[model samples]
Target: MEQISSFFHSIGTFIHSKHQQGVYNTVCLAILLGLPVLIFLFSFFICCHCCCCSRQRKDSSSSGPAHGKKRKKKEEDLWISAQPKLLLLEKRASLLV
Candidate 1:
C-alpha cells in the first residue's frame, strides 16, 4: 500500500511538473480517475441491461407464443432500416481512407 501510494505520487509529480494546472492537468486527471469509473459503470449498465432483457424474453415467451413472431418482424424491420445507414458508413470510411 505504501509502495502503491509512492508510485502514484511520483507519477502525479511528473505530470504536474509537465503542466502546472490547465486543460492538460484536467485531461490527465480525467484519464487517471474518471475513465476507470466510467468504464466500470458502463460495463455494469450493460450487464444489468442484458439480464433484464433475458428475463423479459423468458417471461414473454412463456406468456405468449404469437408475440415472438411480431418481435421477430420488428427486429427484421429494424435491421432493414439500419442497412442503408451501415452502407453509408462504409462508403464514408472508404472515402476517408
Candidate 2:
C-alpha cells in the first residue's frame, strides 16, 4: 500500500509540475481521480449484485414451500371462519321470507 501511494504521489507531483506549463495536466488529473472512483463504484455494484443473487437463492429455496403452506392454511382458516357467518345470514333470510 505504501508503495502504491508513493507511486501516486510521484505521479501527482509530476502532473503538478506540468500544470505550470499549461499542458495536459487537467486530463491527467481527471484520469487519476476518475479511475479510483470508477473502480470503487464497480466493486460496490458487484458486491450488491452478489448479495442480491445469494438472497434470492436462499429465499426461493427455503421459503417457497413454507410460505405456500402458510398461505394455504390461512385461506382455509378464513373460509372456515366465514361458514358460521354464512349460516347466520341464511337463517336470517329464511326468517324474513
Candidate 3:
C-alpha cells in the first residue's frame, strides 16, 4: 500500500512539474490567448468588407441609371411584346396535335 501511494505521489509531482514549465503548456496558452484575437480580427475585416460592398451597391442603385445604359437595355430585352404571335403559335400547335 505504501509503495502504491508513493508511486501515485511521484507521478502527480512529475506531472505538475512538467506541466508548469513545458512546451505543451506554452502552446496551449498561446492558442487559448490568440484564438479569440484572431477571430475578432477576421470578423472585423469581413464585416467592414460587406458593409463597404453594400454601401457601394446602394449608392450605385440610388444613382438612377447614371451608372450605365446596359442595365436599361437588358430590362427592355426582358419584356415580351409578341403576345399575338405566341398565341397563334400555341393554337396552331394544339390544332396540329
Instruction: Provide the overall lDDT of each model, using Cα atoms, as 2-decimal numbers.
Output: 0.80, 0.81, 0.82
Off by over 4 Å in 2: 1-20, 65-97
What ranges in model 1 sit over 4 Å off?
1-23, 66-97
Candidate 3 CA-lDDT value: 0.82
**Best lDDT goes to which candidate?**
3
Q: What tens-digit string does per-residue lDDT give for candidate 2 at 12-48? A: 7877777776757777877878999999999999999
Model 1: per-residue lDDT, tens digit, 7-75?
A: 999988877775676887768876878889999999999999999999998898788765433364445
In candidate 2 the C-alpha lDDT for residue 45 amounts to 100
Query: On a 0 to 100 scale, what is the lDDT of residue 36 in model 3?
Result: 100
- Candidate 3 lDDT tens digits, 1-97: 9999999999777667757898897677668769999999999999999999999999989977664545654465656689888888888744464
Residue 73 displacement in candidate 3 (angstroms): 15
Candidate 3 — which residues are off by over 4 angstroms? 1-20, 64-97
Q: What's the CA RMSD of model 3 in angstroms? A: 12.5
lDDT of 2: 0.81
